[model samples]
Target: MTGIKSIILAGGSGTRLWPLSREMYPKQFLKFGNTSLFQETVLRCLEVSDISEIFVVTNEVQKFFVIGQIKEMGHSIPPENVLIEPEGKNTLPAIFFGMTEIEKKFGNSVVGIFSSDHVLDLTAMETISAAESLASDFLVTFGIVPVFPHTGYGYIKTSEACGPGYRVSEFREKPDFETAEKYIKEGCLWNSGMFLFETGLFFEEVQKYAPSIFTSFENGGDINEIYANVEKVSIDYGIMEKSDRVAVVILEQKWSDLGNFAAIYDEFEKDSVGNVVYECDPLLLNSDGNLVYSKCGKIVSLIDVKDMVIVDTSDALLICPKSSSQKVKEIVTELKDRGDERAYMGQTVYRPWGSYTLLEVSPEHKIKNITVLPDHKLSLQLHYHRSEHWVIVKGMACVEVNGQQFFLRPGESTFIRAGERHRLSNPGKVPLEIIEVQLGELVDEADIVRFDDVYGRN
Candidate 1:
């Protein structure tokens, strides 16, 4: 058997799952349990493959989220293997980059490309092994048996069963409920986005069918050049739908691409009224089949509201019917049009070293409750337009302002003038909590000039 390499694609803005899953930090990083979807996805391959064989491809902004998640799980891959794309350009280019990298490092191995945001059954090792063994010239993807007539997922029609898979006859787009029921009756499977293929064979298909893809990548330049020019097409559109030698492995197991909150509600254990509520201290009267998540810790009781979604974060609230989940993207679109920051950034913002939850913000100033991880440090940088005041509220801090280095304890503070180099870090056993107040000409996030960074920002 060829040594397996897993390419985990952890890119994409899950705007459909807004209020919780923002543009900067999407659904992949959202936690269902102790582990995130991405972390669970990373750990999924380790059952049949080695830890060193796993390779994650994420953007520069969310790469640290990946690292932090893995660290929390205590299952670490080499940092070199965690390839960061300069920007996201859909799945094909990301997979191609990982395929090329796997070939360079491990030599034409079978690479399993899995999306980070999905939840799949892990007990089907036999099906996966069979697909891996049979992946000679075809890209083998797991097609799930449809439980309900869902229009969100694509369909795959197959011919005779071969080993654990069937030769794919055709790929169909998402259909209406009637068509979907017809598909289930016609022995069609839900196109589960998981794919297994040989790296060399995949490259051959790409070179043959997607020559423009190869040309856009230009014989694999740097990651920036690749992401900058690669056509924004998914694996289904770019390769799987167009490929002649695609195979579909029938996975008779529960699978979910939790693309939005509706799918999330389906996976959850519902209450007596068939409601899936998280974070909202619920006292329900007549709410049934609804998914409501609240970050504000308020009582959410309603009357006669059935099959709806109510997501209330600290800064925003989204309420829509279950049928209108697909239209949530339009809300995000309008927010962007109106320069609404809530669409992209949530109340909480992520950094390479740590994360800051926005308590408040205004024109001349912004207030944040910052949490820095132990042994983690932010970029040694200075703001061009803003100066910052840091007050240590919880743990000890290692502060550097201008040319001075000092230690700040609880209730102690420090300030950095505009254009003066400064860095805040936690060099303690506990998490450092600081109340940061930024006063500036303009407190925009883009006013930073990094001199040194621990997470390869240079």
Candidate 2:
């Protein structure tokens, strides 16, 4: 049996699902239910391959999230197998990076490539296995049979049947509503952005169509430099469209890219009035179709509103018509152009040790609720422009400041002056929670100077 491995491409910033999905934390890491979409992808891949055989490709910023999520699942990827890209070139480069590593480890094996942010039905594993088995000479891609004429997705025109799959006649770009309906009438499939192929054959096709990309990897140069220099193009554009040996297996399972609030509404459970609410109790009177997501647990009351998307975070609130939800990216673009911190600053930021939630921020002071996992410690670090006061809220915290070590229980407090080296560790069996208050002239992540870090964040 040829060894099969799954390469999960999880580096996308997913700007389309903004506010909820920030640049630092993307949509794949967002929790729709108890688990995130990335965790679901991990579970899906495990059905087809072992944890050791699974390789994940992510950017440097997202590397810790990937590690934390995998650890939460009680599985581990070999540190070397978690290929980190210095920069996200696009899917082709990211997939190529993971595929190259898999080839080196298990030559010419069957590889299943999956996007980390898609919501898939139960038959995903079976469909992927079918695609992999049929990918001897052809690059196999999974195509979803469109339930409706969706103009948001690219369409795949299926030609003559080739074994269990169909030859991809042409790849159509995102069309207008009229063209989308026409494609649906003519039996087109939505490109699922999933692929299965043999290592050697896939590279051969890549060499033929995308010669520069193949040569960059073939020459054995610095991987990051190669990615930096290569054209930032998707795999569908770079190779799948041009390659003669391309096939798409029709997937008979529910699937959604969840590109917008409207799409997200479809995956969630709805009330009698067709309103979907998340994390908050929402009362809808005369409201027909509304999607509400509030992380702050504020009671949302809607009146006489239909087809609306209401997302309320701690720092931001978005209310827009569901029809124009796709234009939310424009807001993200505007925020980035204006250099607004809300565009990229997530309410809860995850670190290697655990995570922290931003409680408040003002001119002279900042507050955070920090949670450190059991047996984990932050870096031995100091700030140049700020001093920190830590109040233990839960569990036991082993604090170190200027070579002095002491344990602080709940309701206990400690202060570290500016330029003083300190470390906070959770010595207890449970999670350590602390309220951190910073008082200073300037306070931000850039002020930190780490002398020693267990996770190597210097």
lDDT of 2 at 141: 90
Instruction: Please state the error at residue 175 of candidate 2 in Å.
Output: 0.6
Q: What TM-score, computed on C-alpha atoms, does each candidate reach?
A: 0.95, 0.98
Question: What C-alpha lDDT does candidate 1 achieve relative to the native structure?
Answer: 0.85
Task: Provide the clashing-pair count of each candidate structure.
Answer: 0, 0
Q: What's the lDDT for residue 383 in model 2? A: 94
In model 1, pairs of residues that clash are none
In candidate 1, stretches whose alpha carbon ends up further than 4 angstroms from where it belongs are none
66-169 per-residue lDDT for model 1 (tens digits): 88888788778888888888877778888888887788888979988888998887776457766887688688898999998999989999997776678898
The candidate that achieves the highest lDDT relative to the unseen native structure: 2
Q: Candidate 2 residues 278-386, lDDT tens each? A: 8998888899888999978778998899999999988888999998999999999999999997788687888889999999998888999999999999999999999
How many pairs of residues in model 2 come into backbone collision? 0
Q: Per-residue error at 329 for model 1, in Å?
A: 1.1
Give the lDDT of residue 381 in candidate 2: 92
Model 2 residue 125 distance off true place after TM-score fit, in angstroms: 1.3
